[model samples]
Target: MRTLAYSLDVRFKPLFEVMGSLHAYICRKSHKKLDLSPSWAQQVQQRITPELSDLLDGIGIDGDWKLTYLLVHLCPGEDAADFVEWLKGMAAGDLYELMSPYSNLFPAHMGDFRDRTVRLFQQWNEQYMQHVDPEIIERLHVEAMKRKQALPASDPFAFVDETTNGLQFAPMNELKQIILMPQYHFQPINVVSYFGKVTLCHYAARIYLGDEDFLTPHEYRMIRSVAEKSRLKILKYLRQGPRSFIEIVRHMELSKGITHDHISKLRNAGLLTAHFEGETLTAYSLRTGALEQIHSKIMGYIEQGMA
Candidate 1:
């Protein structure tokens, strides 16, 4: 799971870093109101990974294997109370339907979904059973049982009964708060596309505006320049939300010395910010929102140097 988590950081950081840069530029140019809530942003960022993995590992099973696993797990006679409880807790309303006779329901797609669903489940279960450590699975089962016995009915951990309503038990309080945050207060836009544009303009400057001696075409392709790689690596972890330097090192397999140096440079360059939750270092992605605007303006200066 940590490997998958690291993979996510490596894959998406560059893009999100771009998002950050674009955000900064837009705020400055449009002079549009930006929330730029640092603490809230950090909180949301922290939740990105563990939640994502839970959804993927649990309900995102392959068609055939997962289907059979669901049938046996959810059906009337084949009931595993503990498994059902685990499913209920892990299955976000977005991912699965937790009505009686548990099932994984995704939004409609064209074609025969029934057979495809079955096959997907089968493959998922085979892989899951193969990949997930037995001890971990057993531990989850054990813990679930313990919680079931000890906790009260209203306690979030108790999944003894399932609810048909789309709302599932939120694993964390912060998540519940976020879900309940007023969408009516916020503007409606395609978030993915919005973030995408922010990323493009952010990186465009890094790739296109730098001095030729300092940043070559090959470095652009490989994202190999110290600043460039730092930029890429930082963004990847950030796409999953902000991470501390320690988390970044663990995920990127970067030496502490190099990681510290890169983070400091980025901080100086105004691409990253560190927030301490008590003594623990929590870094927030600042390149988005207002910081992106500064990046664009700075890049204009860099472009002038190139010229």
Candidate 2:
């Protein structure tokens, strides 16, 4: 099947990193077993001033995180301070016009949203995002830029899937543009959203630094993904062929949340392939090729140690 062509925009946005980290930090309850756990979020929260905590917590209420993520893209600055100031300078009508196309719900008061969101991001910058390692930021930016250069001659669907570990986000509706952005905080899961005519994909950036202790190794994660009894069963079932997420859930007889978690681990490790049917995950399959590479992967690691 052929994919419709869309204008591809790939770049690293500093605002995305700030928004991504905050979304992960604030929504830690639903993200247990993730690379950064709820415990890590709690530890970080303890260091935050009470006032800032109160302000940021509002973002987690009723999908306000969407507003934060959408709002930040309006700021093109590389620094958080500048991004905050850009938001502060936005006129109410201008802000409304900018956001209207994407959502119908506004904060109870637009005036309050204009003031509060800016202040929250400003303090968020001072208290946390500033401490983010500069090296990781640079690496994500470089990788996004490199992908942008290569995208012109590549199959758009295949490129999106490869960049996001089997997220085949096909073009649909009136969507005419796709932004492929690299993200760090939300590891192991790709975040996809829409606004007006643009589709934004914050693909997980597997940024590993320092030692090779398997902190975020592909081979180790791939091996660890199937270590659990439930995961093995799930894979065995998937070996039959592609099945929608619900079929696996019914067959496993586990809670929906538990089933999704197990599937996520397999997807993250590249042991499974997932495809979207118009923005909804409609199919998942065991990647036999990935299974085949497991042997070579371990051998490659062994070869690395030998060298």
- Estimated TM-score for each candidate: 0.24, 0.88
Model 1: lDDT to the true structure: 0.33
| Candidate 1, run of 10 with poorest lDDT | 1-10
Candidate 2: segments with Cα more than 4 A from true spot: 1-5, 37-39, 213-216, 277-279, 302-307
Q: After superposition, how far is residue 98 of candidate 2 from its true place, in Å?
A: 0.9
Per TM-score, the best of the predicted structures is 2
lDDT of 2: 0.78
lDDT of 2 by residue, 1-307 (tens): 3456567788786778887787777777757545664577887788889999887776653545566667776567876788778887888888788888877766777777878877887888888988888887888888898898988888876677678776765556767787888988887667777675777788888777677672246667888887899999999999898898889999999999999989988998888888764457788987777777777777777888899
Highest lDDT scorer: 2
lDDT of 1 by residue, 211-233 (tens): 45643332232222134666576
The local lDDT score (0 to 100) that residue 2 gets in candidate 2 is 49
State the displacement of the C-alpha of residue 105, model 2, in Å, after optimal TM-score superposition: 3.2
lDDT of each: 0.33, 0.78
